[model samples]
Target chain A: MSVLVVIECANGEVKKSSLEAATYGSKVAQQMGTTATAIAIGDISEENLKHLGAQGIKKVLFDNDARLKNFVNLAYVKVIAAAAQKEDSKVIILSNTNIGAAIGSRLAVRLEASLATNVVALPEISGSTFKVKRGVYSGKAFAEVNLTSDRKIIAVKKNTIEVGHEAGEASVENFSASLTDADFAAAPKEVIQQTGDILLPEADIVVSGGRGLKGPENWHLVEDLAKALGAATACSKPVADVDWRPHHEHVGQTGITVSPNLYIAIGISGAIQHLAGVNSSKVIVVINKDPEAPFFKAADYGIVGDAFEVVPKLIEAAKQLH
Target chain B: MKILVCISNVPDTTTKITFTPDNKQFNTAGVQFVINPYDEYALTRAIELKEAQGGTVTVLNVGEADTEANIRKALAIGADDAIRVNAKPTDAFFVATQIANIAKQENYDLILMGKESVDYNGFQVHGMVAEMLGIPSITPGVKLDVNGNTATVQREIEGGHEIIDAQLPIVVSAQQPMCEPRIPNMRGIMTARTKPLKVVEPTGSATKTEIDAFSLPPQKTGVKMISPENAGELITLLRNEAKVI
Candidate 1:
């Protein structure tokens, strides 16, 4: 039995979350006294596939099907399931991304494996039992889950596990599932990706804004500070609801959850819903004109000053650091 | 077009989360339950579609009797009828199985739900149900429009979005900006009291996973305040002390 890691790639490069998954899968493989093999999907180069070795993967399986470039839920599931069966994998790991969650859930049903998503830690295996800790209730709490099935599927939340770089190179092998036309039935007609901005979920640092930033016209304050820190930009739910930002940039209980290394909240009041999405950041910095803002309680550092004044100074300081 | 919109009754977003003494289950004693905020998007969109086109919208839930209030709230909002699978929603697979069985028997043209429930936050049921029913599923859908036998969906990705097309009999999980969730009117609420709410026994007998315990996240000790004039010091602390910069 082996561990199978599903590596998601876009535009010929591996996503940071998938790299974390590879590392987590390798650790799980080590704990089970087995090896980890990665099944890479999308239009990634073989050279990039071999880089999984840094995450402790021993072998890389690449399917160079042109049709597999974009995500097709059923097609990806068939390919991953084929890889798992071929390797006789007892444990399957994937990053808890939109694509990953889609494939992992379907694979669990098809393979009769117990599935867990938003898993925050590695599994604890003792004898026949496998247990994992996962965030639940929108990160307000966590649950320790026991997987009772013979086979298991885990979707690790991004930024929770630390990525490790070990010395080695993984051997790349070609694999095919012989996908049919039906597999491409639901393929996307057009995909529009943001060209230059850092993706919020994968960013190491995030700078977010709220209604206190005044209007969409004044959003450059948030962006300027983000640029200084080399961070991604985000906003609370209200900011997105009023068209100040796109829905994808909204981080809250009802939106994307991020766990970056640092989260800077400017003018955001730290609503519980908003906090649910960002409270997992390693360090939180809150800046608001209101001294009694709820976000201050959850923040590592707080500055009770106008964003109009504080953010520009912070940007200046960040620029002068190096 | 017959649409099945799944809803979950969860604690209000502002509720303070707590666990029982044993920590095996959530402490719901004082928590006020409402229709999950995300699912409301799905419910509202489904209602709007039903209004635009000519079809019936049915609301489904996997919960006990306590969930019926939210189920009724859904009915009041716009659904024609409701179904509550008499079960605890043990796990994603179990819940998906229940949903799939009903969809298979009824042959719903569209299955709609939130991307994930707020309570367990398991974003698995939609795909699991779609797989079980041999249908295509789109998740975190920001926009959905139906024309004839084809359905168009705008699905959210990491940085942007994708426009996808699928034939009839598709599953979609809704996200924000889809539509503003509607509140039930007095007339609708009065009519909802008479709407059919069928409670059926769960067909799935097995669950793949079990929750061992629940725990709260560690709280921040306290915030280190910085004077407004020394705002730049915060960045210095982030670099030197926190080492995060």
Candidate 2:
């Protein structure tokens, strides 16, 4: 059986998270001695879809419906289900994004497949039993989950796997689920895209600030450093709670959980709740004036300095790098 | 209008996660438990909606007898009544099945729950329940307003959010900025003691997934201290040594 990967794209390009999912699906297919087929969705071009061959995808299934540029849950699930049937895929993989989770859960039930979301590693298939490790307790712990059903749906966590690339192209073909008006009933009234150079979840470097940065007016320090480093800017819970930053920029237990390669936390006292979210970063650097700040314990690099003094120098240094 | 809020009992955010000696189960010996924070958003929003439209708010949990105290706490916070499905929460599949069974029979106008439990972080139940009952679901909903039989909800997407308007009898998972979660006052706490808490048997859907073991992440390496006077050096280290650039 072939493996089906749901690749989500936006702004006419495939998202980095979807690229990671494609790599994961190809690896799973490799393990099973089968080829991986991708069902391309969203507003990406077919030429870009062919580039999924770099992730080892053999063939690409394209849904030509323009309405798909906007996320329609029922319509997405129907297309994915149809693709899975056509490819005779026993395994389905997707990125654990908002759109992915929304459709993946419903697809699990509709396909009668056992689903494991936030899966960190590829599964170990031994005989008929499939085992995979997943993030639980909001990044506090990992649990080894065994999917008992033969049909398995795995939603790979973003940034967990290193994306694989090869200089090859996959053959693209048109595929349709033939939708009806009822499928678009819960369509979004409007889609607002957040305009930024870097998206936090997919960013390699993230510069975050806590209440330690003082007030909203002083946010330029964080933004300036992020600009120099070409990184996304984020905030701790209290900063977002007090309107110092937007809720979408908040990264913590109650907010977004980001696993960037390098997470530079400024003035943010590392609270347990905050750590629970960013603890998975490949490297953590904590900058706080208070030497006793709990975040220093989890940090790979610690600098006990006033942010107002240190950030400018850091930005200057980052500028010199380029 | 009838609203149902689903809450899960989870370890306090401050608790250090540790597994048993065999690494098979979470070590709950000294851990404190609290209502899943995300679920509290849904619980408070449902209470607020019920108070405005003059409807009943029912809090439901699919957990063992130990979860009853937390269920009562939800009732204290403002749920009109409570139901505890007596069974161990094996996985998201089993939990959603029980919730679907309850909602199917009761026919609640709105089914609300947290985006995901902090313990499992499954983020699966809302969609599964909505699919099981063949209803529209808006997940990780940041804003929700109800007028008559129509509900307007704002769901968080990647960067920005989307607004969706749906009819009554819909499922929505609560996220942050939805509504402020309320604490039970002495009067409400006292009243909750006499409120009806109905216990029901599990529907016994076979669990599709099982946790074989639990493990904490690897211990972080020791930090390399750098002086602020050498702030520029830190960036140099990040580029040349750390090679992150």
Candidate 3:
């Protein structure tokens, strides 16, 4: 059986997480003495599909059905299920994304294969046992899960793997999975757009404000810093609930959980609820006037000063970088 | 409009993390466990939907007998019935299998759970269960609506959010913005006592991914001090010594 990786694309480009999934799937394929096959979907261009070759993907199955353009769960799954059957994939890999985990789980049940999500490392294919280490307890710890079923699916966590671009002139091929009307239903009637410079999950850097900012009108200081640093903007749960910021920007236990590379919190006291959502960042910078703020406890670096003064200065300093 | 809500018992978010001598087990002494924070969103939303639409809600857990208290609490919060798949939640795969086995026998329209349990944070089970049943799963959705057999779910994407549609017999792993979590009140607490909690043995094989050794993260270093005024000095310290910029 071969390894199959599902690569998601948007506006003709592959997502960063999909690259990591391909690298992961290819390595798993190597362990099984086979090669990896990728199925490209969504609004991706053909040129981007070739990049999979650098990650050791030998073939790409492209199902460019217009019905599949959007993330219709049924349509996408039907097409992917078809590819997995055609490739005889004993292993399927995807990102630990809303789309990825959602599709991965449904696909697992459909195929009668065992599955694991939020996996942080490669599997230990010892004898008959195919096991993988998965993050549990919200990044607190891990557990090794064995897929007893012959077929298996895994969802890899983002930013956990280093994407490698092995030097290569890769080839791209197109294949089809004939989807019917039954495969596509309940298409989104409306798509709402929220304006922001960066999407929190996709951002390389994030600048967040909290109750410490004092009021909604003072948001400019935080926005200016985010703009100067080219970072996404976020707020603590309290700020979101109080309408200081939109609920979409809330990051905490009861809000969006993000794992960006760099997280900067300005004028926010770190509650455990907030920390659980963001403790996974590669680096954390907390700025609070209260020296004993709980946020400073978890921050890799911190600035204990007034946000009105600090944010402007920070923005000016960051502006000089480029 | 029936809903199935999945929850897990996890250590409180503020509990000091400690490990066993072998580092394989989390030291449970003096640690308080609560329903995973993520699952709270699912539970609250399920109850809310059932209250409005008029249907039963079932709470499922994959842990052993000790997890019954959480199951009961879910019932107190408005779930009609509870099921404890008597097993240790060794890993996501094991937990998913158990949920799938139990779900197959039920006629629920929607399956809901937290985006990721505060413990293990696998975030795989809901999707895996949906996959097992050949059903659609929408994860980390902040908003959900049910009309007849179709469900419209608003799931967060990287920067924006995506609105997706799926027929019933779907799974939704909930995050915040779905609804605010509600505290259980006196009347609901009184009614929770008689809720039927059925315990079932898991059907799938239980061998989890092999763990070589578990290790807690390195100890946190001393909290460094720099005067509030010399903020620029800290940057220098980071650039010169820490080299983290």
Candidate 4:
């Protein structure tokens, strides 16, 4: 009857990927001739929840529980289920994030809904059938999946759908799930937030380095270029493996997958696994001393040169643009 | 401790993905299958725990006969035994149901698996199975250590990571940096041949989702080669032509 969207907020601001989920949910609601309702967990301002209307949500449900601010899987699932029951929601939409994956799968079992994750496109509904396209094979291929259950859950991949801005404002309502102590059992004992100007998954432009940078000492070239471009810094798996960078910054098949607007690879050979992680970027620039590097084939632009000489010039040129 | 580690057989990471003519199923012809890289972490960690704590590690897979080879490989890597539910993993829900049913019968103290299968990339099984069995699930755990009945798991979040502690009977999905996946030695491989491999009929037939088709991603046109001397020109083109800078 209705579409429910899970809007994730941190420090009182909605995450960029959740905004896209809101937009995708609203569009699905429109196609179903119903309105989209959003259920937000944790500590978020009412003003910020109301802003969900800009993404086509008509109603925003907020459970202002302090414990929910950090992700407690059971508690979050119970609250979202309560909202879905209240709204008679037939479809649930969420971003395919770490929290979303934990919540969506459990929610699917709890609600007996058909579940799909890593979905990249809208559902094609024909009569009783609802099919969605999702990225499979580590971004190498796509799979069109049909949700057979009456209730459906979709986890949208980041940077795949465009967020919409509409004129209307959503009405914020207080929602209470009456969670208990048992729900918080698996809550995190400690949360460590990465100290960086830009997060790789949310950044529009990403500057990544690889083993070609030679050593961690020369990482300043990659960082300088990233700083000049105002982009997030990433590296290949080998760099992360050798303790040159944190695993969070590694973008490859087994690492974090990024789909930024622009991805600049410095000194990184384009390995198949690495390409699998970043091939979704809109524009790819490869800078490597080996002109025959396989990465050049997948890149949109290539400048064959040594990173020691080329990165500084690129940084200077990027700075001049400002 | 009775640890159950689930593994999936998938195409080699470098395998060229292709679909059948109708595009409804993956073309497995001539493609070599390996134990999913992520699941290797879980298997190795379980083996390490078994060795240190003196417990049994069982490797489980929800697949047909074709997947038995990879299941044997997991046993070769040091699982005490292996279980194969004879069914094609149609969807995450169905697979979870099968796993939950077996876990309910066996009563595993710890359940381990990959964060997601590289083939389908469905990060759902661990949570779903945990929910089905009425237990806690921690996912993409980069680090895990167990002391008595309690498990301390470090899981990845958006910007960073979180460390959480849960009681026994918890499901944990492994990510990288958890442990170095082990390769089977000749002695282990010989023992794996005699290891008890149990194949049971799938307990459930209901699947929540169905695959309709498969397609490859759009190919990139040729790369625009820029002179290393005119590196700045690349920036101009990115700003003007690509409009993505």
iRMS per model, in Å, is 0.7, 0.9, 3.1, 0.8
Off by over 4 Å in 3: A27-34, A54-56, A122-131, A144-151, A193-196, B204-213, B220-245
TM-score of chain B in each prediction: 0.99, 0.98, 0.94, 0.98
Q: Kindly give the number of clashing pairs for every candidate.
A: 0, 0, 20, 0
Candidate 3 per-residue C-alpha lDDT over A1-322 given as tens digits, one digit per residue, 9 for 90 to 100: 6799999886578888888999999899989999899998778877778878888888888877666776777778778898999999999999887778667767776786777787878888988988887765555556666677888889887777778688663466666776766666545655565564767766667889998888999999888878876788999988998888888798875566677777888888888778767777777888899998998888878888898877777776666656
User: Which residues of candidate 4, in runs, are more than 4 Å off?
Assistant: none
Candidates in order have lDDT scores of 0.93, 0.91, 0.79, 0.93
Report the number of backbone clashes for model 4. Answer: 0
The 10-residue segment of model 4 chain A with minimum total lDDT is A193-202
Candidate 3 has an lDDT of 0.79
Q: Give each candidate's fraction of reference contacts reproduced.
A: 0.87, 0.75, 0.46, 0.85
Please give, for residues B1-245, the per-residue lDDT of candidate 1 as tens digits: 99999998889999889998999889989889999998999999999999999899999999999999999999999899999999988899899999999999999999999999998999999999999999999997999999999999999887778999999899999999899999999999999999999999999478999999999999999999999999999999999999999
List candidate 1 stretches off by more than 4 Å. none
Q: What is the interface RMSD of candidate 1, in Å?
A: 0.7
lDDT of 2 by residue, A1-322 (tens): 8999999887899889999999999999999999999998778888999999999999999997889888888899999999999988999998988888898889988898899999988899888879999988889999999998879999999877889888899999999898988777677998778886688878999999999988999999999999999999999999999998988899988889988889999999999999999998888999999999999989989999999999999999999988
User: In terms of docking quality, how is candidate 2 classified?
Assistant: high
Q: What are the DockQ scores of the candidates, in order?
A: 0.89, 0.81, 0.43, 0.86
Best by DockQ: 1
**Error at A171, model 1, angstroms:** 0.4
Q: What DockQ does candidate 3 score?
A: 0.43
A best-first ranking of the candidates according to their TM-score comes to 1, 2, 4, 3
- For residue A152, what is the lDDT in candidate 1? 98
User: Could you report the Cα RMSD, in angstroms, for every candidate shown?
Assistant: 0.8, 1.0, 3.1, 1.1
Candidate 3 Cα deviation (angstroms), residue A244: 2.2
